[model samples]
Target: MQDSSRFDNVISRPPASGDIVPISAHPAEATSAVLHRQIRHDFPTIARGEGSYLVLDDGRRILDASGGAAVACIGHGDGRVADAAMEQMRSVAYCATIFYTNTACEELCRYLVDSTGGHMARAYIVCSGSEAMEAAMKLARQYYLEKAQPEPRRTRFIARNQSYHGITLGALAVGGHKTRRQLFEPLMPQNVTRVSPCFAYRGKTAHETDAAYVARLAAELDAEFQRVGPDTVCAFVAEPVVGAALGSVPSVPGYFKAVQAVCRKYGALLILDEVMCGMGRTGTVHAWQQEGVAPDIQTIGKCLGGGYQPIAGVLASHEIIDAFSKGTGAFIHGHTYQGHPVACAAALAVQRIVAEEDLLANVRTLAPILSGLLKQRLGDHPNVGDIRGRGFFWGIEFVQDKTTAQPFPAADHVAMEIAELGVAAADYAVAVYPGSGTVDGVSGDHVIISPPYNASRAEIHTIVDRVARLVEDYFAAKNAGGPVDAKL
Candidate 1:
């Protein structure tokens, strides 16, 4: 494979004082101290990116594996996306959705609706995934209020534990991860409950059948709705394939179908937060389509504009839209950057490329290549406890013992180690999107591997090979009575 660190630019490379950063890398001491997420060594400042490679400020080129948390779907330095955004900016840059709408917004909405199996209902463009989640919560509630069943449906939402919705107050309220919610638990809203995730590796009981597991989770949802008083619940939310919070774990067969049935039975709308898993990350245009279930309300972002411009949108089903259309004619929500022409135009360009090039096929084909390569390369590694994922999205979960499926100690910083290795040892800049609480809310460690849809085979191999080598080396050094040096 080509050298992963052949970048063309450089910024904050390691200082001579040694690569060990303080706990926070607080500034004011020596070299440029920036408390980066991964303190492997000083991070190289990226100058530019092209295709699936990030050009660092120091003239080194690095393979981009996870697409910056799976955001850069179309690879880097795409002139077409730039042209589209520039054209929209020249025409109309800002028009808040509260006052009026623009042609780009209208066209983008139409494009999304037509692509989503013609049942788009409508689109509400927001600024980010967290904002989209916040919008989805409010919108789901409004749908019922407009339908005149506000009292019975105002009580709750059912989300899965180890699933990430967002960090906003309402989104975090329904988010189930314990550590994320521990500090502000006293400040969160009531009525939102979390259920066990559909993870088979960790959550599945020994000797339990997949059918039985799905049935059990479905029953759990039903019981939660009943506990909250079924008539008072607004929505049951989950990622079609859980991301970040639980790596890339998908539910067992019939999981969504069964869960959807429970929501139908309880008269609560089903909300799928595909912020990290949707928009062809899982091969299909929409992740929910693979499960044979559709969401009443769905939130999608990340790949929506392929990171060319910040954009997120909630896909409302026709029924959800009709309730508001007939009752209030307004959704009772507002955003200053909603349907910003530049974001919509950028998204339109991305969607057009995806459709025209049939990139979903690329995602489908490359997914197996990526998954198989990772497995074929590192399947027997003792530290790799599990390899799970779907589509272009994937994850590698580490454990102290594979047979017992034991995660490395969190303080051991397994995920953080691999993340730093990507730079210090391999010269790659991939994403460490998910980690922590793999066994619970604070003990396990896993790293997400979501390559760009436009990544080439050479780049993917570099990513896989380097990551495997890095992980193996870290353990090897630690086993040899060393500190598992972060400087490599």
Candidate 2:
């Protein structure tokens, strides 16, 4: 029999205090051919992944607590997904979507449409979340043109501040993430407008009730629509749960309903970007379900493929599809790899596994446990200002002064430090996603903890424990006036 202990023993021990480890700028970086995200930073080379742990080439096991920005919903190294991809590749790997539709793509689209209980009439599969958002924006424009009256004037979009939709030029224009949009402002489409997000932690007043806040936000959106000439607006874009741009920020009660009403009033479609928070990342398969609002056009990714393949999709409502079916009978948009069979097959397999294993139920069951433990561990910490999220998608916002809820200066890079230390230190070899601009677009820091949907009770506890210890020790060191360096 093979020794299972061989892999387990790799991460059995932690380095002693003051031991120096090279976390960045690996020796291979000097002549590495690949252009890494950070030129100077040396990333660990992963040999393989097993369940929730990533085994490095050097034989160290690192716990993947954040699921690599909440993409790996089913964890790593599932042979079933690989087999599905292989099978699809063996049959037909590359077929231009314009020329032909494959079984895998058709099945996956059907599955997505059914998942929405037929509310979404069609699914346009793409390669990434950015492409999905781009498709959604273009489709929204086409939707207006497809109408009987041909409202060609509908060219503008209203998106929430501190919200991210995608990275492409079109998607970036609609996104309100200040930092990401700053350099690209001159090149972005000028048709998009901004409105205040429904973030209760910062946007809500101390004296205001949830209902009052919702009304205030709705009024702001309405006022913006009027200011922009509602007839020119194509849609109101927002993230069901604000992802990277604002950490895992969820809206207050009745927030979506209020916004949807405003959108309807202005004859604008509601586009909810669930790239990071949907597909069972939250308790529900679709985050908008929890909000009690179904978007006219929804973009889903990340967990859609569970990191098994590069796939994202845009779901269109029946009304939009009907308009298209009657008008041009074509979307007038195309991508070379729109519905690659291998990608669709991999995503289909992942989604089936999620449903067959009943992972959403697991997520719902563990949501409270994860939230309770996080609050119990870091709720009262001097620097922990807020802990908010639903299901496994939680975020811990760090503040310079908890009483005043003042964020640490942007120069401090608090979130990145915690994330880097979590991966660098042998004592806490766990990974969490970091966000820099949680407060506005330039200041504040928060870390997202999005465990896999199929994560066990014990795995959740382990994740929380490691994260809490990292937070506590890091702050303790800061309080002691020490360097608080992960490296020696």
Candidate 3:
């Protein structure tokens, strides 16, 4: 049991106020008014970015390994997206969706729906994934009201345990992260319930077959629907691939199909939250493409605008839209920036770049190479418990005992330390996305590495090599009773 605190130096911190602070110090001195994500931790000031790397204010070049939470799909500093947004701004920056819809908005929506092969007939563009999810929930409720056999009691939603929907009140209510919800539990709505996620690594029995595992998970969903009263559930909400909360764990084959069946049996809509996994991050334009099941309502973000502008959207099936068209001709919810011309333009440009560059093909071709490299480097490491994901969206879960798959205590902050070391280590400068509560929403540790879609094969290899070295060095230092890294 090594002390986690001994690794604090892994992340460079800025000097205290009144002194000339280092560029990496917390950006909040008496002169600084910015409210940072963490008040106590030092934050590095980013100066600029290139293709797949970020330059710190002090000129430290770090590879954008996880794309800053997998949002920067086309890499940073794309002139095309910026130009598109500026072009839209010059034409029309803001238009109320209720009154006027801009061409960019309409075109972006058309592109999204068309990409779905007409399965998703409508699109509701918003500012964030949370907003998209919130919109989806509202639409589902409104859809039932428009139905001939309207079930007014269908206000509840059934989501999965260890799943992450979003940060807003409605979105958070459906999320199952125990830690994020602990303080806000009293404030969140009580209409949502949770069932087990298809986490085969820990949830499945050792001898269970894939089919049996899928069947068991489907049974759990079925039982949950019965317990909650099928007629009372508006929808069954889940991520096509569990993100953030459970590490990038994709469902087994036939899993989504089985869950969709359960939702159909219960007469509840199926809502797939692809905020983190959709929009070509998983090689396909839509992650559900590989699953062989279509969601009644789908939410997408992250890669949608490639971090050029804040944007997310909801895609609804023809049936959901028809209900509104026939009943009220309107959805009851609206956002001030629901269809901002600038956001839509940026997203359109990003999507166009993805298509023109044929990046999805690159993802499909390179995903196996990255996976193989990771396994070759760290598969036998004691802390490497599981390596799972599809396409370029991958997660590496850390554990205390590999044989038992026992996670390290949350207090150790294993994943966070690795991420910090990746950036702070003089030899290996790469950014990664780290998360906790991978086991039961309070105890597991994992880190995600989702490089930009345009990341070259050499860059992927470099990213994996750096990640492996960081892990090995961190533990080697711990065992030798030293700092977390050799050159931190």
- What are the C-alpha RMSDs, in order, of all predicted structures? 4.9, 6.0, 4.1
Which digits, one per residue and each the tens of the lDDT, describe model 3 over residues 55-144?
988788999899988889999999999999999899888998878989998999999999998799999999999999999999999899
Tens digit of lDDT per residue, candidate 1, span 256-340? 9999999998788899998888988999889988999888999999989888999999999999888888888888888889999
Off by over 4 Å in 2: 1-22, 26-29
Residue-level lDDT tens digits of model 2 in 1-488: 01111111001122234423346434335867775454443567899999999898988888999988789899999999999999999999998877789999999999999999768999999999999999999999999999888899999999988877877889888887777678789998899989999888899999999999999999999999999899999999998788787788999999999999999998999999999999988888899998888999999999999888999999999999999999989999999999989999999999999999999999999999999999999999999999999988999999999999999987666777687678878888998888877888778888899988889999999999999999998888877878676742
Alpha-carbon TM-score of each model against the true structure? 0.91, 0.95, 0.94
| Model 2 TM-score relative to the real fold | 0.95
Alpha-carbon lDDT of model 1: 0.78
Q: Tell me the deviation in Å of residue 84 in model 2.
A: 0.4
Clashing pairs counted in every model:
14, 1, 1
lDDT scores of the candidates, listed in order:
0.78, 0.86, 0.86
Off by over 4 Å in 3: 1-27, 486-488
What residue pairs are clashing in model 2? 25-42
Worst 10 contiguous positions by lDDT, candidate 2 = 1-10
